[model samples]
Target chain A: MNTKILRVNMERLTAEFEELPDAYRSLGGRGLTSAIVAAEVPPECHPLGPRNKLVLAPGIVTGTSAPSSGRLSVGGKSPLTGGIKESNVGSRFAQTLARLGIRAIIVEGQFKEGYKLLAVGKAGAELVDASQWIGQGLYASFERLEEAFRDRVDICGAGVVAEMSARNSGLAFNDLEGRSTRYAGRGGLGAVMASRGLKFIVLDGDGAPGVEVEDKEVFDRGRRKLAEGLKAHDVTKPGGALASYGTNVLINVMNEAGGLPHRNFSSGQDPRAEEVSGERKAELIQKRGGVRPHACHPGCIIQCSEVWTREDGADPMGVLEYESVWALGPNCGIYDLDTIGELNRACNDLGLDTIETGNTLAVVMEGGLLEFGDGAGALRLLEEVRRGTPTGRLLMHGAAFAGTALGVTRVPVVKGQAMPAYDPRAVKGIGIAYATSPMGADHTAGYSIAPEILGVGGKVDPLDPDKGALLRGLQRATAFIDSAGYCLFTAFAVLDFPEALEGMVETVGGVLGTPLTVDDVDAIGKKILDAERTFNAAAGFTQTDDRLPEFMHLETLPPHGHVFDVPAEELDAVLRDG
Target chain B: MMEAPSVTVRLFARLREAAGTSEIALQAQDIRGLLDALVAKAPSVGSELLEADGQLRQAVTVMVNGRNIEFLGGLDTPLRGGDTVAVFPVVAGG
Candidate 1:
């Protein structure tokens, strides 16, 4: 098997291929990216400085025919969190890179000169001058790149937002339609890529060797078992919850649970939230001639993505995720999908993380920059980011930086990273995950909301403050799935069906030619998380950093009148001994 | 006579589509009765919400006044007049 680690030295403008070390042979996706970042990058180095490195890797089963398994992990020291971070995304970009016989791509060192594009093909890899592409929005930049490169090439890059080295910029990957929408959209990894002076990484897999699977029959068996579970489950099956409504289904679900954060995390519920819901989105999509139940990548059966469009069916914005919708919608007091869709369009164009962008706007509004619920004002503020104005810089540094600058008291963040759509007070289990995740308040790090609020895995009290052990188990298992590169939505089925979990293990085992049972998930996942934790600890993070904002504890959210009352000891318990 | 705890039932996602409306009102004293009334009113959605043995399907998530029935009293949780009851097929997303 060709396990080649491609090392790109930006300062030298050189690309070299190296044999993957035995230590990294078994790791892939988040596991591999975090492993490389922990090993090669200095703990104390400035995130945007010369010493920092960006690592991108496809998950173990990413390139295979495994269903819904096309997640790419982008890892680096985060300028936003000042911790080791792995931002994950789903797109054809991952499958293309993996098929080229590449195990991982390590982008290292800074390039003071203008940006360069790294092109990898069956022939060889080379760096081309990409100065002209710099300072352009991702929409225009991706369009031009598509025209410049062959149709087979999958394009990925940091957009204009990254040119300013903003803390909220994400690395944008092309979706199935060649739109620059899919993203590793958290932890300011795009700024790290920008700092490396690399605007784009284009992978052309034409005529290249595909993924190497050691045991074909075993892989097929596992894939079949998983496919059956997905096909049978109410949430993952076709015409089921996810396929019918897309992930925006959660807008109503979370709102009903009183877990949906509104207006900068001040309240948990908003009657207006249903206005931008997945159900509503689906109806509009049908009426406006947009595509629903769409896949972000090939081989994805869940299809929890959609093409949101204008009422007249003119401009097509990519998927409005539950997080994106809530972040840009009710969280900003803007109920209209058009306003939120435009906000999402701006985020995609600028290559900024929508979750961070929404929270920044909320904090900015709370600081008196605009009134709460000002959708027009929110639209105007994004222009500042394009212009790279002083206010825009503050917004791009993420919610914590903006909240601090504005002296806003209720900055809802953990480790300088803003919280997502779910409020911890209403959905207590996810709050624990938020506080303890190595990635800084990322819901995907440990989504206990499945059990806590949605009743997917198993029913649990959303108000319960005693989930330390449960959160730990969830976080560990999540690390494994993220490493496997399965869309996290697969967890909806995997949780309810034991066969699916076993099937997941077998798929990875089949790919690597190793014997992996369901029993091995915890230890394997823990090893990956241990690497990230060790890096964070070395970078000066303490147990104190693993805590929700003080306001969560002090203030009670309405509707449910719940506060985040999980004990400090419990939060500490989740991350320790990992 | 006074109304039999006239609670409003809100459906979501698949349930709403199946029922052909987002909200419905019915008189029921407890969650079990409300669900029974719900099925009687919207049999298409009712078939999805209840199992063969008449137990609430595992996929159905029920919350009353923004609180899950699990924390309150499960199927027997009482409904009062003017209360809002939310139900769905337990969709999952981060």
Candidate 2:
């Protein structure tokens, strides 16, 4: 798998492809992005300044025929959290970049004037002045790009909010259908792109030299086993839970566990939450003629993405993921799916992350901007962000900043970024993930939910506080998966089937022509974590930084009536001291 | 006349579709009796919940109140009237 790094200097508007360095040979996805950012970007530089750089890389097996392996990692210093971030997304853009033999795209320097589009193709990459796309909504911007480049091209671009340098902005990637729906939506990576004066990265795959496998026989063996495991598993199998209802399936599950945050993390459960659940959403999709069991990218056997539509099936909104639903729905005391669906669409259009925007809106509600459960009111507020109102600017900076502005003390954030749907007080294990994750308040930090992973013998209590080591191992393994380019949903099958794990390890080995065994998963993942941790340390994050918000420690959540009680020492040991 | 001792058996996701109802009022004193009542109310739910070996299906997650039943003694976990038993075919997501 030979590849080169494509570096774009916005100051000069120059595009150059450099030979892939030996140090970055085995790295891909989060591993590669974090490495590039940590090595090249200054920790203290303003995230929206010239010194900050945005790096995008596909996972090691991203472009290959590996099942569900089309994930791209977009990393940079987050303006929101003042920490390193790698926001992952599933899109054809990743495969297109990987197919072009471009391992990473390092965007450097600031473009002071207007937005430009970076077009990469068989003819080699070039910069095109795209100032017209600067202020347009992403959906329209993406449509124009599709028209300009035609159907064969995939797109990655900053949204309108990102053009305004909103901290809550996320980079939108065109999904399989050319819709600007999929997002590397966690950190403020979009603003980082926008800051560099690059609005879009379009990849034309026609006549491209696709990803070459070093060992086809080994790769095929690994792919088959992984596919079989996914096909057989209950959650990932054809027409299974995820495929049937999409990711919003977790709405009811988390609510049942008393871990679902409702009304700005004030409570843990509400009967109204059922109105926005996956079960309810799937029924609505069926009645309205929308598509469930949709794949964000090709070769995704899990196919958990969906196209959410209006009552008459008119205006399709893509994939109401669990976190997005929760953050915009019950967490704001709004139970209507149509309302949440509209909010989701607005976020996609403006290039705002649904999670951060939702959390910020909740804080806005608490601050007396609007009453809770006001769906119409929430939409109007989102309009403010698009219109660049004074209030909207405050909201777009994200939850922590919004909370401070709003004077709300019940902010549910870790390291400036808002926590997702799960109330950490109820599910202590995931809370540890939120607290200790280098990316800050990320639920995806620990994807290993296996019984064996949780504990060797028994059904370990989720409320148990001694889960630091458990989370360390889980996060380590997850880092490898994120770097490998496999969808995190792949963990559902791999957790239950041993062979699936072997398949993942062997596939990477086949791609890189190096033997990586199951025993190496931890060490390899740890390497990525270590780099991120070191960068964060250099960025001035300390032991106190590795904690759930102070509000979590003081406030007891309802239903479970528990607080986040994991010891600081436990969290401290997660990195495995040198 | 007073209602018989009952626990609310709530279903979610595909489980509710199979059972034909989201909530079922079932007379029971423990998790085992609750299963019997659930089967009596919706045999489809029973088929989806248990295997031929009479063990709970691996995918099915049962919780009494908010605590997972698997951690509490599986089938033998005691239940009282007015307790809420939530069931879902466990699907992993963030």
The candidate that wins on TM-score is 1
Model 1: docking quality category: medium
Predicted structure with the largest DockQ when compared to the true one: 1
Give the Å error, residue A24, model 1: 0.7
Residue A172, model 2: lDDT of: 97
Off by over 4 Å in 1: B1-3
Cα RMSD to the true fold for all candidates: 1.1, 2.0
Query: What are the clash counts of all predictions, listed in order?
Result: 0, 0
Q: Which pairs clash in the backbone of model 1?
A: none
The number of clashing residue pairs in model 1 is 0
Q: What 10-residue stretch in candidate 2 chain A is worst by lDDT?
A: A448-457
- Candidate 1 lDDT score at position A9: 97
